[model samples]
Target: MSKIYQLVLHALGIASFSYSFSILHSLSKGESFFFSIHVISFLKNWFMVIAVPLEGLISILYWGILIYDEKLLFDKPRLPILIDLGFHLIPAICLWTDFLFFTKEFRKSHSHIFYLLLFAFSYAVWIQFYFIKFGTWPYPLLSKLESQQRVGFYFACFALCTGIYHMGAFVHTIFNKSLPVPTKQKDKAL
Candidate 1:
């Protein structure tokens, strides 16, 4: 189970949880002196660009596989209901909520596509290396796939993640547009 942290899903979940906690703590104190503004901004952008779409992908793929063929992901022992939801569902909801409602930094741009592609490719290499070193895949799905099939799977997932990112950006645009902007009230001049 120690190797579980190397799984992309677990890694992204950890990132999502950490980001949520960091944002909450920063908001509570009204200042983040620990990190410089540039570092904070970079981290925020990285999280929004890479982590958000990846989490969405993880959520969708995980639930889809779990529903379609549970045996593919697990053999006998199953995660508890809450633990499963915590791992597979809540990170997505939290990240998407933060992306849609609280964040305005995401915009439709080519750089986002680059970021997604970069992350997808990097993860593919990392997982391949892990498989080479460990004699077992992180997921049974990969173990069943041949080399070419795994490449295709990774490409398909990258495309899916790109689509998800664009969809989130589109929703963000429409949501922000529909929201009424706040206006300050003027005192009565008597």
Candidate 2:
């Protein structure tokens, strides 16, 4: 993958996570802000929905491919252990935690899946265009595959990512149900 492209996506996920965290912190401290609560909530939720699956896909695909074939992912000077983990693991974990715990449950809809497909399609276009210009795919594995196989690979990724997104939502539901969460209670007369 292009370093710049990877950086941009990572930066986006990190920025969204930071923004969501700050908003949560402010709410905890009872701080007033410029934006309405609803607007803030909407934006944060949308951001999480997009970022969580993206980061999840990155981590999932990276580790999966690494295990399957290391040469496909890295060159002679491999990334340091910490740097590799930082890039491929931490963001997914952090974003998944934030999405599952901090945010309210999002309404599950077919539209969400559509959005994911749209993202996948957009990325496919970018990567293919890059390959056309550069005369090589970004990842060694991609270059090795036949064109039909590449399409199948992309479909598999889309399926896996969609599963990851739904799995988080499912787990979130279970955790919220089984745990004792704090809520405001009315005072009774003494």
Candidate 3:
């Protein structure tokens, strides 16, 4: 169950990463400087980008023992052998590599969970849009769930997102503890 959940999260991450990269690249190359504002704005400010990396952390921390019974790669021969690696493995590797080697301190706030939930909520809105357009839910879980149940599912996932954010913040703190967190204002004389 959680394997499928992570697979969905991974797909969302890939899509978000693609869109963000495309918009930024278009700007850098002067290809669509004026046309990608909406996309660029969302990628720059929205929490959509973090969903997968957070899930990736969850995968790494507890790949099979805690999250689910199945492994990330399906036991049955399904799709190409490496497709699972691309979707399930590489993204997590990239996320951890970037965090361990490149990310800056205090680059994110612990309070960013609200922003993350906002992004998830926005995705929920899109899920509704997709269902209306296609007359089917975007994912199997949503499809299996009734209207209110779907809402409950999303709320539970939002709570999960909140927890993921705190975990990410903790990891970031551990990785960056040596560096002083910058303050907007210094302490004054007392």
Candidate 4:
């Protein structure tokens, strides 16, 4: 049951990423992709509201395991969990930096990055799946690049995201961490 749940979670992550990527790619190329069926439309709607946020939450959990060496999720030296952590953390950082520093509205709302990262992360997963099943990468750069280079790219992305996460975490820690506690009397009066 645990294994099945893990597989479903991973599949959900992949599907959310793929759908976002397809939408972004189509938009970038000035094309339209439509969903005619209700199920497809429902999934797409939920991708933005639910799946993307879940991805960010998973990324934070990954970072907690990797950076803080938390043991709650898995035993130590679990290579697959480590690898999966790497996968989510890299793009999570990328999207955060792109939003916080590069874009206007996104700086105020970091959650926007969740959706953006989903697009890139999904593409990476799809490329990996292609490599695994057909033994060839769909993208020319990924296909032709040396194994070391590809590994480096993945790590580099992780490092970049770690930096951004720290920065964002710092900002939130300092500026946004505290909130006013409501009084019980005031609450009751309201």
lDDT (CA) per prediction = 0.78, 0.73, 0.57, 0.48
Query: Which tens-of-lDDT digit does each residue in 6-29 have in candidate 1?
Result: 474565665566476448535544
Between prediction 3 and prediction 4, the one with superior TM-score is: 3
What lDDT is obtained when candidate 3 is compared to the true structure? 0.57
lDDT of 3 by residue, 13-94 (tens): 6545744543463456443575555555445434334644455644553344224533323343344537646655666665
How does candidate 1 score on lDDT?
0.78
Q: lDDT, candidate 2, residue 17? A: 67
Error of 4 at 112 (Å): 14
Worst 10 residues of 1 by lDDT: 24-33
* Candidate 4 residue spans exceeding 4 A from truth: 1-45, 80-82, 91-190
Clashing pairs in 1: none
Error of 3 at 28 (Å): 13
Candidate 4 TM-score over all chains jointly? 0.33
lDDT of 4: 0.48
- 44: Cα error in model 4, Å: 3.6
Better of 1 and 4 by lDDT: 1
lDDT score of residue 86 within candidate 3? 62
Would you estimate the TM-scores of all the predictions? 0.82, 0.80, 0.58, 0.33
lDDT per residue, candidate 4, 1-190, as tens digits? 2332354367456544635643553344322345433434344443433333344555764566457644434433344765564556654554443323332211224553554455446646765776787675533345556878876755555445444544554554455444689877645654
Q: Give residue 158's lDDT in candidate 1 (0 to 100).
A: 100
Which regions of candidate 3 deviate over 4 angstroms? 1-77, 107-111, 179-190
Angstrom error at residue 21, model 3: 7.8
